[model samples]
Target: MMNDVVLKVEGITKTFPGVKALDDVSFDIRSGEVHALVGENGAGKSTLMKVLAGLHTPDGGEINYQGASTHVAGPLDARRKGILLIHQELSLSPELSVAENIYLGAWPTNRFGVLKKRELRRNATRALEALGCGFGPDARVGTLSVAMQQMVEIARAEAFKANVVIFDEPTASLTDTEKDQLFHTIRGLKARGVGIVYISHKMNEIFDITDRITVLRDGQVQGTVETANTDLNQVTRMMIGRTLDTYFIRAKAEFGAEVLRVEELSRSGLFRNVGFSVREGEVLGLYGLVGAGRSEVVETVFGVRKADSGKIYWKGGEIALPRPRQSIDMGMALVPESRKEQGLVLMMGGRENTSLPHLGLFSSVSLMNRPKELAVFEKYRSVLSIKTTGPDQAVSQLSGGNQQKFVLAKWLCADPKLIILDEPTRGIDVGSKSAIHELIADLAEQGLAVIVISSEMPEVLGVSHRVLAMSEGAIVAEFEGDAMTEENLIDAVSHHRGNVAA
Candidate 1:
């Protein structure tokens, strides 16, 4: 697929002091293409891949390459012109090894000089067995596993011989068999012609590993087509330029009885023999894949880890929480999936990080009461309608879907009954993920109890009613209502296994 364009990118643009983040951005990238880019979350596709990997400079146009005209000033001048990138956070150096982080700082020294450790462990085990990358070049990249530190950052961008690589969202924390082993190392870097570029949000992995498709919405260029003549509803209507709505109604729920329950919950090696039962109008979901422990079974049902054995029943007696301030004095509310590292505060103020973990119920004898925390942040920022420019702003200048609706108005103003959430719409935007799935179906029609934990199988079959799934760390399959489709819930979250009988 190389009609020889190699790379163009004219009219580039970029800007920041008030956000323009690329406009007039023309495109090209051909030589051995894989392309794919797409967009939506602050759509500048990581600021035009950080201005084509020079880490931002383009305040205007031009960037040809191989056909001439270039100036990638940073990442070691685009790694001496071969161009690398690969981020979605995985750069390695987790206390080195894996052949000293694959010949880090160009090792091989000797000739009466020193540091050559047997030819740097035989050329880092022949560049990780020529990219089959099974690890063990003296191991320990912090005992590897965020998919083996993203295959040692793709064997250090195939030992820096990258012919314009890029990647970015690299299977957003892999695991559909490690995303088919990263599509066999991106089809061996497109049979060695290399020009990749990938960035994703997983439209079935950009229609199963792109060939050509470009999208990018606000901040320009929105069309490139050709991934086998496109589809995934036209690359999601050219990445959210419209025709959106992927169904998620769920509103009429209204139950109330059993607010919570669990029996054999054990958290030994993280999630085991877990039991369930939540009512007050349920949702539940859970499902798995990225380390199939589903955030250690809801942080051990909200006591934030530490269980080793179980019991938990809330409405019908028992309650024994070992921490998280007795699971927030037992109203229990989590929502964590690193929303700005475990949910907000970016130097504070979207109403003081939404009343910072219920500031001890707005303390009085020990101070804190600024007009009752600004009238409890204007009443949950007008009950999670939070667009904010005022509750004193700065929740890091908002938007990643209003910083996840100010972390869902800080656990719905900590008036929890049992929420949990984790991955509650990661990296937000389809109109703030349909307004946080209609505020979790209006907080389960005002009864609360939620749970959630997702990996987006159509948002756990549209805000789940009863999904479950998980794998390896236990609980295998459950689904409900016309068997939650998306190919049977992504094959019950990538191949189910044991304990599921609920």
Candidate 2:
């Protein structure tokens, strides 16, 4: 690792109208180092990254770059100085081609201001190849999967050849294989003396990729420790200011009667011959890598997607789910993977989102009972420990963890019999992850049939009584208890074939 400090923030403080996002934050990143920034949601990690990226102007601070102190004027200026920020929420234009998105504002042009399309395509292809992407430059971004889109964003950073790259939850959308690819890319960057600031809630990634770890809590710096000198527990304690319990814990469950059973489900190009069953008081973990068709199977089960041919049985009777509403009316709730996209409306307030699906509960002849809605929102707000200024705070403004809690609140209000949680804890912090896990256990104890689809191996094994591994759009292996392990699950998903037995 290099000793030269590439970027330094001294006594930095940033404040919003009602919040001091960062306070006297002193941090430095050295060339050829992967420095980690870890904290709970709303703990000021994003705010600090924003200041560094020139997205937010610090109220007070000194920013030093390359042994010279200077103010970052804006995002463009920061990038020109070899600083780049890959935001957690994608900011790409879905309609644009991958090449156009890569060179978006920095389009190659002559002094006459004419666009250079050929150069853009060529460079984008080279960058995409460098990032190990299979897609070509002309491919429409909207047509790409979430993992591919994330790779495009990384490719943009690589093309920029930035000196100090700030990665905000870069691997949140990637699968284990994709994450390994990104780690490889990161190591390459580090070897080139490019400083990286990695922000993620997943401690395994932090320990595996970073050289130094910095913990931020309550808008201030807790401490920065050498990676070799610390462990997950210590870093987490610094983040939440408490001794956190185990990451995932599920109580021994006595499963009730079968709630959902799908037999020989097929969806042509997406998934085929998928079969599974979920029983009351049991968590059936659907484990797979990205594109392994876990979400597709659940989507079909919820009537979100039509299956080519399949038999679905609900409570021992074969049933046809023609629409989502039919499944909902039968006490089924699906917590989609993209919470912002499908779980909840971002522009709506928390209270409205929580009660939006069941407004009929508080409506009488086209008249909504306002106080009844308020009470319902309050009950879940307290129960889920959702952090918000008030019920009126827009869901778009809330952190990922809190927004996910609201999604949970929305479905919990429905009091469904069977819950399909897709990536329940994706893109959330450790503390919030623990809370959601506890809530899952509580739901199972209360006898709600839970089907959890997750790409995280530890989570699938920890939360479920049994797991069904999917590969190449089909059920490959079944794991439970003693057989439920990362190694075995990996082997099952990668090696097993033609075994749709449940």
Stretches of candidate 1 exceeding 4 Å from the true structure: 1-5, 8-13, 20-45, 50-59, 65-168, 173-180, 183-187, 198-261, 264-312, 315-330, 336-405, 412-502
TM-scores for all candidates?
0.34, 0.92
Give lDDT: candidate 2, residue 488. 92
Whole-model lDDT values for every prediction: 0.77, 0.89
List model 1 lDDT by residue over 105-223, tens digit each. 66778788789787888877777888877667888899888877777767766776778788877866666778898888887887788888887766677778778888888778888
Model 2 pairs whose backbones collide? none
Best by TM-score: 2
Worst 10 residues of 2 by lDDT: 493-502
